[model samples]
Target: MELRHLRCFLAVAEELHFARAAERLHVDQSPLSRTIKELEEELGTLLFARTTRSTRLTRAGRLFLERVPYVFTALDQARASVQDAAAGYHSQLRIALSDGISPERLSRLMALCRQDEPDVAIRFFEVPLAQQLKGLHEDLYDLGFAQSADVDDGILAVPAWSEPLRVAVPARHPLLAHKTIPLEEVLRYPLVMGDPEYCEGYCRQVDRILRSVDQVPLVTEQVKSLNLMMALVAAGYALGLAGASQIQTCRESGIVARPLDRKAVLTTWLLRPDAEAPESLERFVERVASLDAERRLTT
Candidate 1:
């Protein structure tokens, strides 16, 4: 009839004795006897066979006991799941990232987060700036990381960190002639760029800087990630643009990096909806902003 009735029935079914079931339930034997009688009367069937020496479950009682326990287990599991979500503890934290990110830097930030919140799950999506903007507003992501946040004004974007825009050059490029090349001189040559659609946030700034100097850079090639950008540059396609941290990620072969005119700063931003964020989101933003040092890769 009620949850308590189901519980009483389950306990009595398990023990097969009124006295023992009463003790297990922390109730008096008289109450236990009354509860079983009430359960049987409600169900219109005898639940147990009783004798002076022992008590045992009937066919119906055994079946019901199995079903009732399963129902309770399902209810308990659902309750726990809700509590976990309300506490801002998800099995996974869904993240949307802009392309051209330095894998090394991203890995380091993740290691720090995991070191503290071991149970937090990390699910990454390589999303374009347009997708990040739309999905974040619709409550589809817990966080969004971008080379810059120039696309959306509805989202609260905070500068999390910055890395120098390194120009990855081939071994014999004239640009490599300078230990730390200047931006103006580098722009004179064609530039290989990441897809502007995905990296609109970063490329917009680069475009602005180039326009100020009245330079229309020749497009040599297009790439997605910093690793690929560096690879293309190493093959001598054209000069490449990337953050200093990215250069560190791509220092595998003949690629070389130097400051591009006073080390043009490439900023990383922590993005969330402009509306009030959950405590979990706030915690992530805070941890990212308080990093003690720069990015590093983990095996």
Candidate 2:
């Protein structure tokens, strides 16, 4: 089939509505349907199952949706390659780090890349986990650090590094008396928490731990970043769960961090889109993968 047919199919696949897809493509209803029919005929499979008022992608459509975007990504990368080659510029890397990465870790990462790959220019975006997922799909960011979740097929994620999960307690808080606080024990105090819609995987794991003992966290505060969450904890508002690295420098800043008595922690990952990443992007991925192998200054 022609590329136009594929585009039409993709439009319908995305909107999941015949009329909307037709409007998006700047075409009328009948032509869009015909194009989808032609594509189905060529592929020998029905992509969508339709009713009078609604449409949904079939299993085949779901699989195809994961792949078709890669085609466009490859095309975009190819054009960028040619343009960069002609311009005499080597390559550029763009990265997105979640708020959980320690300030020291970020400083070291920047230093390491600049020292080792001086010819490459690096840019960083302080993105939340939810935005990172969409940016990865949009090719807006080359790589992202987040917990693994429902990632699409065209994205490849590697376990880069993990920090011990710690409980943030205020200095005068009664829980500070214990050298190691139990997860169940923390239920006595209100909790300041992250927004699950943005940080889905971490929130899910935290919920599983508390739910096992039939406990519901008294969420006194809902926050998206560790900085604000820690601030609230320091202000004697609520306790919080965050990476140990985040609180390494906070003990003197009036916030106390302690490990949970049972096994409780958060894991971070490095994700790369599958289509085509620049050389600089690939190098950053490799460096991040090997970061733990080196001496990471963790508290």
Candidate 3:
């Protein structure tokens, strides 16, 4: 019913223990318990099931937990909008990034936006692909970029740009003997891949490539970022697969990026709600298209 109720509910739902949640909230256990009880009575549902030894969320609690974080996100965005307005920004655009989008490309796009429209405040949120899609639908984000185009009906996905997928090899590794590594040879060694939960779009793209080969890959580890994957590859723990630009930007030493004998490309898509766009959004989309065109011309 109130902010405090939501806050207390979230704390307990996350901690799953009343005393621990109270400790986290810097409150006494009795008050925290009372707050939870008050919230439950108001909602007319049991949020948590507790026993002497354990506490866990009921079905209703789990469902409520799903929608609670968005409350805080909305509040934060509102605060940020006020701050941006005070800073003399006429408007704000919330853009979400998912699936470990290429930093070089994003920087170029952001620089272009700043140069073309200095009055517009561009805010970026790095979230998982699932969250990105949900935010787009909920109007939390105006647009998003990701490696996967797969989406539900309410969202539209269009290819913005693409880069070649390359294999990241450690220095002095046997695979480096070949200038262009074959897929079969790359799969023979263990690989460090992106975790699906964090990099769903990226994982989907990479998984499709891996599935093309008949042989099974030996994945040494699943990491959440390209930096970690490159680090593992640099250390000779395993090889890695990533976009060429991503491999080029990685500062880790002893990592060599080799192209595949066969061509493979990863495409980044611009995702937005499937509805009529405002003039500003239309201009932004045009800028994206022009940039991609320029890149193709120069490349």
Candidate 4:
């Protein structure tokens, strides 16, 4: 079918609600439904199983959804390739960053890339995990960095580096009395935490850690960035949790970072589309692995 059909199908599949999908596509529900019906007819298979109360993807729809992003990805790459050629760039690399990357490690990686591929221009996009995943599958990004291991089979996540998770407290906060704060005590204070929708992987890991302690976190504020979370913590608004790298690099005053007694940790991972990776991507991956090894040796 046409690209519109695929777009409509994807919207419906993701929203799982006819009205919402139609609104998202800025079209009426009837036309969207007809398009989906036509797609199913052309394929000779039902894509979605819809009820008045609930709509869900059928097996075929589920399978198609898994593959459709690649079609748009190919189109996007072609456009980007032509644009890059017109701009006189010899080569281009698009990378998506989610959660937050380690500044130290990322700097080393960039240095390696510049040394190894002097002619290649690099682009970085800070996006949500879901968007990054979509872009990766669609070929919009050559590589991605995120804190989650919840990738689909089409994407492989390699742990590039990890740092001990630390608790960020306002100076003189009761929790700071202990050199290492206990999980339950950290949860006792209201937390300024990462927004789950924005920092899905990191928040999910935090959730898992909190759940293990059977403590419900009283989140005072849900922030989209680590810097803001630290700011709030320093202001004595709430306690914050972050990796040691972030806490160490934070310039916010009145924030003391202490290790957790429970040894909570977060890992930043390198994600690549599970296809035959490009030569540049392969080299970058090797550099990342090498950096990890170097870090381990020095530490």
TM-score of every prediction relative to native = 0.65, 0.66, 0.93, 0.73
TM-score winner, 3 or 4 = 3
Clashing pairs in 2: none
* Tens digit of per-residue lDDT, candidate 2, span 28-59: 99999999998899899999999997899999
lDDT of 2 at 31: 91
Better of 1 and 4 by lDDT: 4
Q: Superposing every Cα of model 2 onto the true structure, what RMSD results? A: 7.5
| Candidate 3 per-residue lDDT over residues 144-174, each given as its tens digit | 9999999988999999999999999999998
Rank ordering of all candidates by TM-score, starting from the highest = 3, 4, 2, 1
Each prediction's whole-model lDDT (CA): 0.75, 0.78, 0.92, 0.88
By TM-score, the better pick of 1 and 3 is 3
Superposition TM-score, candidate 2 onto the true structure = 0.66
Candidate 1 clash figure, as a count? 0
Per-residue lDDT of 34-104 in model 1, one digit per residue for the tens? 88888899999988999998888889988787568545644654565576677676665667888666677
Q: Show model 4 residue runs off by greater than 4 Å.
A: 1-88
List per-candidate RMSD values in Å.
19.5, 7.5, 1.9, 5.0
Q: Higher-TM-score candidate among 2 and 4?
A: 4
**Candidate 3 weakest lDDT stretch, 10 residues:** 276-285
Ranking by lDDT: 3, 4, 2, 1
